[model samples]
Target: MERPRRWLEDKLWSSFGPEQASANLRQALSKLRTALGEDADLLQTDRASIGLDEARLRVDLLEEVVPGNERIELLEGLDARDPEFEDWLRQERAQLQAMIARAGPKEIRGILITCRVDETAPGRDRMTCDVLSNQIGENISEQVRAWRQADPDMIGSTDAPQSDVMIQSQLVHEGNGHMLFIKAIHQPTARILYSKLQRIDRLEAIMQSETEIARTVFEAADQIVGKLPHVLAKDRPETRSTALSRLGLYRMFSFDQDALREAYGLMDQAFRHDENGLYLAWSSLIRLTQMMELAEADQAALMEEAVELYYRAMELDSDNGLVQAIVSKVRSTAFGDTAGVMDLARTSLERNPTSAYALKSMSEAYMGSGELQKAFDTSARACSVARSSPFKHYWDTGHCFISIACNRNDEAIIAAEAATRAAPLSRPAHRSLLALYAATGELQKAQSVAEKMAKIEPGFSLDAMVNDPAYPVRTLRNKGLLEPVRGLL
Candidate 1:
């Protein structure tokens, strides 16, 4: 690649004025030439522009050049303290990662989805059925493609009959309405991976229920992808990466130090293989979770890493709704950037209305801004959309906090208990339950929750938590809600 001198100055030293930027660039190029020494001739430059001799340079990132055993990042940790340069670097890294992924060995899995209208069904509108089928198919296709870990090649059509899974559906008359019976069958194993019946009361009502139906089926298919590594037993890097990512996601919610460390390692491994925006976002979320659960003294280091990872994730895939949602949560909790969190969360919801994660983040932003009513409503939506999801505890925890802030003690207790039941190993969930139990004068219940917390963290201390600025206990104390729990501890 060739770059004009002016462009280089603006990119590398935008923080400084033009004169200073130009001088700094010249000084940096002079040092680079000195370091190049014998390879100095490869650094081709003119009065107007600078270029590298691509023919002579053996760039490992290029498709033609094979990579080494050691993993290396392009210009790793080189920061010019300029926003423009940082943006450019992130884009370049994303492009390089994409190139490498295309060059690597991987498997492309496809789903052959077909919908047929039952001839026995009365008053069946072909147009309506076609529209409904297309909508559901498109929804599933979009959801699958969004998950880079799954590595879905394409949604197979009649023209392209090849597929790993066949999702067949039939629309038939039901009680005063129609029912769509859907089943996902693995092509090789001939196993039914998923089976569900979606009820549509009316042809017009199909639009309303389509999103939910697609989500249910897509999540099931995603689970199958998570287990593909075991079944295929091939050296498929993408399948292995998906398996690692799934394990990491489950472990990340444990809120235990050792489990979190293991989760981070797993997520890091997946990110290394895929280098995807979602992978980076998940890794960043793990870092933020570690920051919350780790000792206050160790939080600073985790915070720095989390911030860098989230920023890079955003830069690589700002349009990705899930990526934006994860980054928004990090910004809301770790950086306390309420304005940025609200913007990112809102955009995420706009892009993917079914995303419970975005809804939770938006609710948190509202709570932090003292918009209790908005927070409550948004939190409720989060819970509703997250129905039966394995990660429902996350939304429930947010709802518990919002309910507490709104002085809905009964609702708060319900949500807290629900969160605790959903994730028994989650310290935050236990803390929420304990807080609610204590605040409502349930001493025995509070003590039981506290005991569970102790089991999760052997060195659990109420005093330390209440005083530590890193924990949410400080916020609860400021609100005059922790005094009741303090007496029990």
Candidate 2:
């Protein structure tokens, strides 16, 4: 059955069942074809025989190829009633197991589709796509080149002539942003080695969408680089990309202006050098946060830029759960569109129910809509989910708000303190804590927190913040449930 040189159709079918030879073989092939989708041709078939498509399907039963160190477990939990068939399967498994023991994870060749794939995609420009292809291809090629030079055992290259492996990728508009998909394929046999999907969320009122593209390219490079070992002992451009990628998540934990400026600077260099939607998204968030310190006149202009940045990010990949939550919260502000806020919150939760950010944002939306019980339940779940996340501050803050609404002052204080501790450096976390203390008539504690906040931000005054246009959100909360303690602040 294994030998393909002779007409072994009957022998191959004999291994599976003891029935009409031709019928069973045909049935099995048909089922396999259905499962293979576009790669059904890998199971080559002729009128007189059957064989593997060696040209497109390379099966390394020996130590030859490994795709991203991925283990392909075969015939798992499979059972056969026939003694002969079961014995044959066992023999095959034993042989494969021996090969596996000798084989190591060393990537050879891969492909990168550096071309304009979505010509018909709405809002997509051919020239822009071509430029993007060059930027992305070059950066990825450099990273892999650096890695390969460090690791002598790896045999493949993305830029090598007649490379054994290749990567195909494309960008398409999705929701408010865009999504990028990449598939690695073996060249000799045209078999998909591996694939990945990523969301690029940032595109509100973007002037230079190309920057977003460059950022995502570097972001994708970081993903690939992570799977492979440091081909080089030293860091390269890919290392910088890694640092930038984590900035977005890190922002939720720490809100240091100097750190944000450094991250934004790195993002700008990378965009000028390579761009991604997420970079723009993070930049917009940082800009919005900076608005608190800007003069009132400059606030409007900066916010407009921030909105544009967000729009651009969204056009690239709106499905980003954290971005969705951020957008939802932004739209919930006094100057924001309530309908837009609700829509984003609902969609964010739909995409990721366990997302601490999404759940926290949705809970706030529920609270704003007077759904007190629902808000408390959602906030509770957010806290539970966030216990293991970097942005636990979000759920903690949500809990503080919802608990206060339910007149649960003790729980509110505890949750507020938790938020403060989770991200002590975060301005929002500190603000939430201060608000809870002041609203509950904990004048002494409020004074202590106010002093701490003063060190974080000079001239800390609740009245001044609420009156600031950039702090419309603070005003909204103050006017609503926090009305009881207005004079205390």
Candidate 3:
């Protein structure tokens, strides 16, 4: 009900006073009318009544955007000097909040935390996180509640929706390129459901990225989420295998020795339950990784086991590019067989040119052999495939190896540092960094890297590192750089 002019007069009196109160009200009403000119019918007013035309007015926040609990305040910064008007505004907001709480993210469950948009970062990358977040919304295949930022009260509490899966996304610029990394996290259990790292330099191609970026990221985001429903499925062993393999990959890239082995065991279980060639290949790859990083008891034995696994993988699917890629890497790293590496890499790439695993093997083959430039080129391609990926750093170690061989010591140091940052758990990255430091005659840095490597893989020896087939030709080059450190070890 419209209180008489006396009411509004009191509401603004503290600031505007009664004299200007009426004038202020008239002005505000006029402005309101102008703002709502097209929807003027929604504002119902008569001599004795001032109210919204209930039937004509529909609140977008309340009716749409289900469980829209995102709003935290109402009429913020407005000053209704009179207590009654202030109370009215508060009550209206409370009513709206009640409605929102009642909605309770029903149709949409689960949370998605996109990295905060960074304002200080350079290039179109400033809003890359936000663009990916918005893109995820557009392409999300399932109905899950999402938030740019989660409400404080909802975290770590069972009272919130039981949706266990959450997706955490980050956009990073590595050296010269932009990378988008996304991971589906199981909130309650605190486990990763799935994760993805994709190249996003394509954003630069957009006419106006601020406006067009989301569309490009949308397809990328969708592709990841589209696989989520299946990958995150708990009932299916094959699906669980997919999830475990992803975790294994993350751990492998990060240099987490124990975690990767655990993933390998889980993959074994998954494979046994359902004979998935993917698991077999990954299992074999992880075993080989142990030989290089954790210092497997018998390198030859590990190599033998890996080859047997790959044989089965090939038997299961001769055309599996990822399996083929790992086999090529094993051949390269174990035997220093450059020709075999080259042949397998080409064939694997032919099956899946986009496979980073294959590209990495190709890079390793070139570095181990005498093709430093081609190795560099292939490593660059792998980094481009997923620069934000841990695999990028994995391949980057080889890239640095090639760079050092090419007499690009300075560049090699930079690439080595980047590799270490990308995969701190990586023994090879640390070794590369140490070798680069020693080669540059920076014994102090080399000593520091040696200590770090020892902590991760106790009693880490340069002999084990230098003699390994990881970088055959480069090993000879780093031998002098490493010999002095052998006594220190």
Candidate 4:
């Protein structure tokens, strides 16, 4: 009795008894051998000489007859005599040569030819014939001459013969051929090299070219805006209003309040009669309001243009979460009204449960309201959503600042250290580190950090620090911060 076939017995014939399974296994093995192109004599002899159990064990022995890598060598040996293989090889070689030719003429100052010959043969006699037959030496000289003629700026002589030609050859006893190596060097005068450098000096010529292309586009846009005022003061009030509303939106970035006012007046004129024009006017008003935070206003105008833009944007696209979120942030920050902002934030969170921006906004609102724990929770959620977000620095730095504010110096130091590691280039991160060092009575460390900040922004000064908006000097002083560095300042 013989052992059973593992795959056939376990999977296909597992339900059958041993004898029946063995019979099925034999039939399956026969089909596989025929499909694999095994000779009938070898298959029958092996099958007949062994019992079912023994034959199953012999399968592993038969598998080693053809190794994977040797199969390719065997295929190549057989292909050498096949006409189909010869035609295919010729076609592939021609395609490769064509591709090389398409790359165009390349400069060749040296040539290397390698050949293997019978070691038992006379070395000098074998090399003499091989050198004469090989066209490699001639091809290299031609390439060098062509290259010199094509580019006169190239550092080489066109008419002179190669100054040096070196050859190295190797012989293998078992192989039928010898290995030959050749190198050729072209010589040129030193003056040619200097000329090449002079040709490259023209790269700086671009600085003389005028940037009129960019200036022309700006001038055309300005002309269009200038014509809008006349068009808006027309009989067709609706058309005029639409033009004015568009102009108002365009003037938002211009920082020209007079132009903005003129555009606004035209928009207002259109809004009185055109509902569609009202939305545009309102949207422009919101953008303008957002830009006014740095203006001379003592307090941010909450009931003014920002709210109007939000309402207009909502009217145009009620489902736009981005517009709703911005509007909510402006209302909360400008008016110091967190209740409405919190509710809007929650709504935004419901829409995009995993949004980092929404989470960060919620955290900011909490921080604004002096709700430290809530801010931390919201910030943690934002970090979970986007660990590598630049906003993470904002949250981490804010957390550190809050810790400092509460006189938790150790906790503040830990958070500040993490923020600095996360974004070393961030000014806020360095500022936090400076504050942490100063609070911990590390004046030298604070000064070192301040020096780094000064290197990044040369205008960073103690006088500028006194009026700095991001982290004010008064706040630093009140927190018992920068006290040690006061002498350095």
lDDT digits (tens) for residues 6-93 of candidate 1: 9999888888888898889889989999999988888889989999998886442332232322355668889878899899999987
Top TM-score prediction, candidate number: 1
Question: Sorted by TM-score, highest first, which candidate order results?
Answer: 1, 3, 2, 4
Candidate 1 segments exceeding 4 Å error: 1-161, 202-206, 209-233, 368-370, 467-470
**Candidate 2, residues 194-288: lDDT per residue as tens digits?**
46676766432122433344334444444443433222111233333433344433542465666555545645543332244556666676666
Off by over 4 Å in 4: 1-326, 405-407, 466-487
lDDT of each: 0.69, 0.56, 0.60, 0.46
lDDT (Cα, tens digit) per residue for candidate 3, span 246-353: 545655666565766665775675465446576687778877877765445577888788888877877875665666777787767667777888888888766544
What TM-score would each prediction reach against the true structure? 0.68, 0.47, 0.51, 0.35
Candidates 1 and 2 compared: the better one by lDDT is 1
lDDT of 4 by residue, 178-224 (tens): 33222222232111110000111221221221122112212222232
Cα lDDT of candidate 3 equals 0.60
The clash tally of candidate 4 reads 11
Using alpha carbons, what is the TM-score of model 3?
0.51
Give stretches of model 2 more than 4 Å off. 1-239, 251-253, 266-274, 292-297, 405-407, 461-489
Error of 3 at 366 (Å): 3.5
**Model 4: per-residue Cα lDDT at residue 96:** 44
Query: Which candidate has the highest lDDT of all?
Result: 1
